[model samples]
Target: MLTQTVFRSEDLPVADRFDAWCEIMGRVYAPMKMTSEFAADFRAHLRCIPLGEVTVYPTTFQQTTFRRTPRLIRQSDPEAYHLSVLLDGEGGTAWDGHEAAYRPLDLHIVSTSLPHETWSGRLPATIVGVEIPRAALPLPCGRADRAIGRQMSGREGVGALLTQFLTHVAADVGSYRPDDAPRLGTVLTDLVAALFAHNLAAEPLLPPEAHRRTLLLRIQRFIHHSLTEGDLTPSRVAAAMHLSRSYLHRLFQQEGITVAGYIRRLRLEAARRDLADPAQHCIPIHAIAARWGYPRAADFTRAFRATYGMPPIEYRRDGVRRQPC
Candidate 1:
């Protein structure tokens, strides 16, 4: 487990901020020579978050250029790969005779073992990065290395999902605990591998856990969208998503319910909300039930009473009366 560390260059005197930043950067990433025309005007902040086995840095810096020289590579290399996602400004990374440009929502990787250069052109350049040990990726290093300095996008597909995930993690970091580290690390690995798999057209190479997670999220989203469709059922959902009925049931089994049961529960919950809403009072109880896919008022009332301990009309009057004002 890794505790979060924050560093802000604004906390230092203008004369000391640059050197202090270099010192911290050396430890967090790797030893490197950094040059920035805006160093005299330097202002930066970084969140060093450790997710069990990997470290992520949500960083912002003014115009800067960084180089990993051969001499610097041997000093204190972590032998890890840095996956950088540019959140602002334009940046470029070059290594092994290849160069890639990164704009907002673009991502690329850099290998600490190889000499490379990255530079920013705009004002404050904000980026989120994860440093992972080569062995943790489940991919051959050589194949992965080819992607170094090659710009990829974080705007759609798995890339978009990853960017959202990272941003969410950064925003919710305060709620995370030490015990959550290993699971968080696993999530990071799965997302990264899935991204690479999608990019390289190697979906079969993705970890089983990643595929399972992707399917579950997609299914839940579909359930939420189809809640009001009267004909929605496990068989129909499976057909729409191109999954076997048995497989869909097995997936929902992990959630302690059959797929059909899950859909029914969602429909019932929606019906209950409508029933309790004063604005919905003018609407007939049968209409509200049909609105949530419960065409039969008797069936809806039975389920509602079983769950909430009262009939729909009685519960609505009681609930509304209990409200002050």
Candidate 2:
């Protein structure tokens, strides 16, 4: 039930696209002076999804320069952090006498309380930005400021998870209800807090709930990435994450499942998907099982049969029969 706003420059008169974009930017984010060579016929698109106190804007726009001057800051400042994950093109931001160049998959944060200038390269930049109010983030200003304008990798660790979560939420806006917005906002805020703490080496600053949630997310991501490896197990996962095996089990216990059960369930789910896909029909059953962490064919057959109540071959055959000609 969540609502979203879509903007396409082509919907307006060619001569007015740039001005309209500027107006939209002011309303969506903050007041800023934006200039672009393509202003005459600026081509751009934006989708805005509001999540309680936070908002997500996924946009693709032609090269543009944006400046937030002290005068503008004085006039109005929402005191929010505009965190942008650059998906395409090149760009950089200049703030507080510091400049950082960024490419795709780089996270850039700018504080609305401070004046800054942002510019894109010749190519149109596709960015998924999360605008989070300063009050929503639990970290102190000084701690958060240390990360602003600095290049943070959105390709790995908590940064990567946050980036993925934002992009997924933006892409799948219709999958959620209005009542889910606040909850989504809470999750987003926690991830941002966790990322900031991780970067600052100040995990203790986060509330206990935030810390536990972040660690669980990290563990889940690690398991998904390593699902194909043969050494993926409770002991290996615990060792790699530097946690005791018992603690790992206890963590999964909260979910009403064991660590081993979680791993097996994930593997089975992956295998089931592949088995039901007609395109993968030619892939041997044993080969498909091995690809999903079950190296031994017998072990995979036994597990898959117990979970799905049918042998892999029978499942695939049944799936194929149900497909339309």
What TM-score would candidate 1 get against the native? 0.60
Please give each candidate's TM-score: 0.60, 0.62
| Per-residue lDDT over 1-325 for candidate 2, one digit per residue giving the tens place of the 0 to 100 score | 5789999999998779999999999988899999975676689999989999999999999978899999999999998989989999877777777666677898888988889988877579999988899989999988887778655779999999999999999888879999999999999999998888888784224345444644665576568668889889999999999999998888889869988898898889889978987778999999999999998999999999999999999999999999989
Lowest summed lDDT across 10 adjacent residues in model 1 is found at 202-211
State each model's CA lDDT, in order. Answer: 0.80, 0.86
Which residue pairs overlap in candidate 2's backbone?
A: 1-177
**Residue 274 of model 1, lDDT score:** 72
Estimate the Cα RMSD of every predicted model relative to the unseen true structure. 17.9, 15.7
Q: Tell me the tens digit of each residue's lDDT in model 1 across 1-325.
A: 3478999998888779888888888888898889865465478899999887788889999767789999888776788888878898766766777555666898878889999987776368899989888889877888777667544679988889889888878777877888887788889888887777666663234356445644675676567678888889998999999999999999989869888788887788778767666667889989989988889989999988998889999988896897668
